[model samples]
Target: MKLDDIKPDIVHDVTGTYCPVPIAETAKQIKEMEIGQILELIADDPGVVEDIPAWCSSTGQEFLGMYEEDGEYHLFVKKVKELT
Candidate 1:
């Protein structure tokens, strides 16, 4: 099913490069979603291994899980609270 099928709280296109900019954009999108909703992040950047989880923990968002599909990384994070 499409990631959107999850009807995620938000979607972030972290594809291309896993630099700070895309990751930041992902965070921005996630922050814009509703609380307790899920955000699906599409990334291929290796830095996401550190960036994704770090951002989740640092901000108290719930890092539900992630998986690799084709050549991309699909990560899902639940917004447990609003960003400051």
Candidate 2:
């Protein structure tokens, strides 16, 4: 499926937040999501460019993809594993 065509189950916007904040919020948000649900994180922090994929990798979740739009980053993540 095209990244632009993806419909997220949840959308969290952390526009003015910086590094760690974006990641931290993402973790917290993902924890409440059911497996197979998609999360669309909108942030202005460039840190998410690296943080999101890395977080998903270490946590065993799925990093679908990401794209930048109008100075903001749009990250797509899928909950593939249940948080313990």
Model 2: how far residue 66 lies from native, Å: 0.7
lDDT top scorer: 2
- Note the Cα lDDT for every prediction shown: 0.79, 0.95
Off by over 4 Å in 1: 1-7
TM-score of candidate 1 on Cα atoms, chains taken together: 0.82
Model 2 steric clash pairs: none
lDDT of 1: 0.79
Writing each residue's lDDT as its tens digit, candidate 2 over 1-84 gives 789789999999999999889999999999999999999999999989999999999999999999999999999999999876
TM-score of 2: 0.95
- How well does candidate 2 score on lDDT at residue 31? 97
